[model samples]
Target chain A: MSAPVSGGDRLSAVRAGMAADGIDALVLRPSPDFRFLGGRGDGFLVVTMDGAAETADPRPYLPPGVRRVGVDPEMRVRELFGLAVDAELVPAAQVLAPLRLRKEPYEVAMVERAALAADSVLACAPELSWFGATERAMATRLRVLALEAGCEEVLSVRVTAGPGTAAPGSAPSDRVINPGDALLVSLSARWDGYCAEVARVFAVAEPPEDYDAVYSVVVAARHAGMAAARPGVPAAAVAAAVAQAVDDSGYGRFAAPGAGRGVGLGSDEGPRLRADDDTPLEAGMVLCLEPAIYVPDLFGARVADIVACTESGPRPLTTAPSSLPVLER
Target chain B: MSAPVSGGDRLSAVRAGMAADGIDALVLRPSPDFRFLGGRGDGFLVVTMDGAAETADPRPYLPPGVRRVGVDPEMRVRELFGLAVDAELVPAAQVLAPLRLRKEPYEVAMVERAALAADSVLACAPELSWFGATERAMATRLRVLALEAGCEEVLSVRVTAGPGTAAPGSAPSDRVINPGDALLVSLSARWDGYCAEVARVFAVAEPPEDYDAVYSVVVAARHAGMAAARPGVPAAAVAAAVAQAVDDSGYGRFAAPGAGRGVGLGSDEGPRLRADDDTPLEAGMVLCLEPAIYVPDLFGARVADIVACTESGPRPLTTAPSSLPVLER
Candidate 1:
């Protein structure tokens, strides 16, 4: 098991980022950002952009220089608000976002672990037979797999089978898989407070004769997008590459212009791969490239992989095979 | 199966609320509020103060809407920012509190179902004494129970046992339940997109002599607070009653003054039960009354129940017996 990183180490990174960004202080709401910096605080935090800091004794576990804001008088119990007086208190809504958007080394590591776990779960998809298995059952299996893989939580598991199998962002229904129906399984796992997401498509009975054609198009698009990932590259180029591939394959209508976006502490992280997004890809950033083509009311296919931008190029963190649809008996 | 409420019925409620609150328009983020308003946008909704609304078709469901804006060019794609053309896509952060704080009848019903599921999970707590049962195992059992009881999802299950078990908001650890350790199980279940939370303290072996005294104090405090749960009562009075009971029992340190808060579609709903809060209790509101006392490094006891405020008094939604701690072999 990986040893837990100390609160001090995590706070230092935040301080460094604040200095680099010219931010005077950082305020984090009661979301994952607060938990990422502070070891424990149910409320919110206002981290002064100063150098090293420390919480007083008795509340030793709280983040340094962090203050716990009272819960919104309308929202939280007043007595609970004064639980930690050692740290400064502030309103949660006042916390800004730009400072919390970037990921730190430890946070990145956790995201990578969650991504690997998602990949592992997708690799085990063949074991989830289509027959007699409900969408919810498949989802439950995926969740169990994620937890066993050291993920603290499973954010979501959306499985759709047959013609009605919807696209990503859709909730799973009780639909049972049948022969020749397409199965799309999208899952996100959280490890150490970071999120990793991946999706896999399966051909229930036998692979369609044209399955390779569709799969090849998606894989090519994913590869094109991944290859284009590097520091200073425009986010839209990555999205356009995937969209162009789908359009070239005569599936433009089904292809979502942007394949996917960044994956980190949250299921949907920052810096989206879209036609209009101009944010440049930065080293140490992680993203998921999911190129999808949907034939409405008929079938849909998506191939997603978690990739991390490194000094050299984008490295695929999810090693699960994405060549062709797995035909399960 | 409960029939899904119609869009017209939901719209009518919004219209009525708008007239009463004198709100010109309500911008809803793509969270539960959007769903509660009978629209499945990409987590974004524009409701005119006049009650006319337009929302993006939920990607997979693609419900009808007047105009749709794709993902924003500048914002990160994963973030819940809706692009709308015809409607002013105002930032939803401003109106979320007001729209969600007040509960509608349909929302109350959904919350009631969620609370019922939580009660059902608590009912099965006694059966978790199987040999070699791990915290994860018990948590999974609770989740399964909630799912089987028709909960679409489980918000969270926080189970802390052994020496560090008394504190509220403690995350679940991997420690096995040994003899004489206190097991604190707090769970929040979600049904039809509404959340309800409850907690209970369990003694793995024979309880200490002071257990009954402390337990009775909490129970009486809970009853006292419940009696004050009328439409016009202040939120702080409820908390003060619980605190007074603990102080009267000579266990003031263990008494968490603000142990209860509003419970509804969200786990931490509005109108907190704290000594400083002055928000008046409303008849349609549902709240969780959790009175807990923790002696550091020793043991803690908490008894939580879901209560719905009425014009007459507070109606206890959780029927699980809280007379004494369950002593397990």
Candidate 2:
């Protein structure tokens, strides 16, 4: 089984959750929540107080006089309409989300594998022929490498060079990479259904103006975030730790809102490392600690790595380079 | 603009649709419906009769007293719960599905580009070193080639060899391609937002037993389906034509349920070429005429191609070989 809960046990857990929430039945499509409950293939999984089963038509699995139904959040509107049953539909996340907050041992390993595959792509970046390639082409190469590294699916690959890095979540463009340009390459890939993310910064030929200083600050912030992730600590504390580091460096305003997020079946999940969230850290919780600083139209720096919160401390799933690597011409 | 409808026009069309459907507002995430309405990036789009805009939080855009809301079919349950709107939620497809049945000129062009790219990948299949490669490896190669050919996204790549093809929708696996095995490769890719699909069958150094006959029947069925697809013809008629061709060859029982489906913004859309769908095939509508015969535990043959219903006749976007192409040792 891929998760700690499987078969009858998984159904029992879901049923317990449903009863507590007063939900009559839980209807799930093929999504992270479904996978977390040990669901396989493209079918609807229906969980009632008495039984649980996967079917092409969930109506049959649902109770005859079902009053309320918790539907998959990822469900398409078209499918919701097809349900046709006269039941008040609610988001299944009410009961399922809390259950998925903590990762299982099997899930943690899957995340580590995905993280290592993504990290390996960055480890080989220096040897790639990147001098004259466009950001899109370079991103494509990295994706190919990620696939070759045994990633079952490559979610997204972002390659931003020079000014492009200043824009948050900038997509790969046709802009050619030039010497002295600051390149930020971030990759999110899935291995065996679990997702992990890794992002690293590099200078085309040499570090651009203020890049080294900014890069150092981002790295320090990532370290702080990692240190603050531990059992019993509030998720906001991790964000605060990252904020404090960037604030100390006087680049506080440039620090992004989300310091990191829980990662596993879904790239972004609960325990969001934001100032407003207070979800406590728990053992077996895997997270992508990304602290980024964008300085307007100028160059920016970001470093992301996966970490698993445990009783002992934070166990880093991916290794972040201590210093920025410059791709020599 | 990538689509025929631009800012004001797209919103106007959506507003018109909402008014007709008695929907006070529409909430769309990053989905095919969002793309069809010319939405970009990861943002929520809220459309009302009076105004339309994209935002991070859609609640502000929704009318305070709104009683009915149409949500994106692909919206997640979490997002659905977060909507917090006291309205009867419905699928937006009711209004949007019919509008998307016919493709605009620009949309058709994009679909054609995606089809050609997928076709090119199959065209070069003979040159690929597939003798010792696994089905998954070949699928990966096809995906990489699709990306190189400027496909913004590859929906899926199916590389089923030998008995695996008999299992419908069989995913690429680790099974090695042998000398006498039959290989089926299908690629669905999106170019500039529009999607198209292409599937072709091939023989190894030597054809498998009874493979040629089954493949010939499939080809004839595809031809019949294509010939039946025209302006003013019912979609079901086309499906019937494909069924008749397979039935004449005593392979009716083995024929897949869906002969094909409309291809464009969404990989699979309305005007479904099935016995149950009587939607008229209008000019400018693109269809993927796929006919297949799967003999349990033995072998199967499937040939899929894109055909656009023109004023005069069917315009094939993808070229399916008249006969199976044999990959030499």
Per residue, candidate 1 scores C-alpha lDDT tens digits across A20-98 of 5444444444356566555354544546544322232223334455444322112222222224344433333233233
In model 2, residue pairs whose N, Cα or C atoms come closer than 3 Å (at least 3 residues apart or on different chains), thus clashing, are A73-B76, A73-B77, A76-B73, A77-B73
Candidate that would win on DockQ: 2
Q: TM-score of each candidate?
A: 0.74, 0.93
lDDT of 1: 0.66
Q: Which stretches of candidate 2 lie over 4 Å from their true place?
A: A1-10, B1-15
Docking class of 2: medium
Query: Residue A78, candidate 2: how far off, in angstroms?
Result: 2.3
Error of 1 at B102 (Å): 8.5
Q: Give fnat for candidate 1.
A: 0.00
| Error at A13, model 2, angstroms | 3.5
Write candidate 1's Cα lDDT for B229-289 as tens digits: 7878788888887888778888987787695888665678667899788987777777889
A180-227: candidate 2 lDDT, tens digit per residue: 999999999999989999999999998899898999999999999999
lDDT, candidate 2, B152-252, per-residue tens: 88899999988888998978989999898888899999888888899999999988888999999999999999999988889999999999999999989
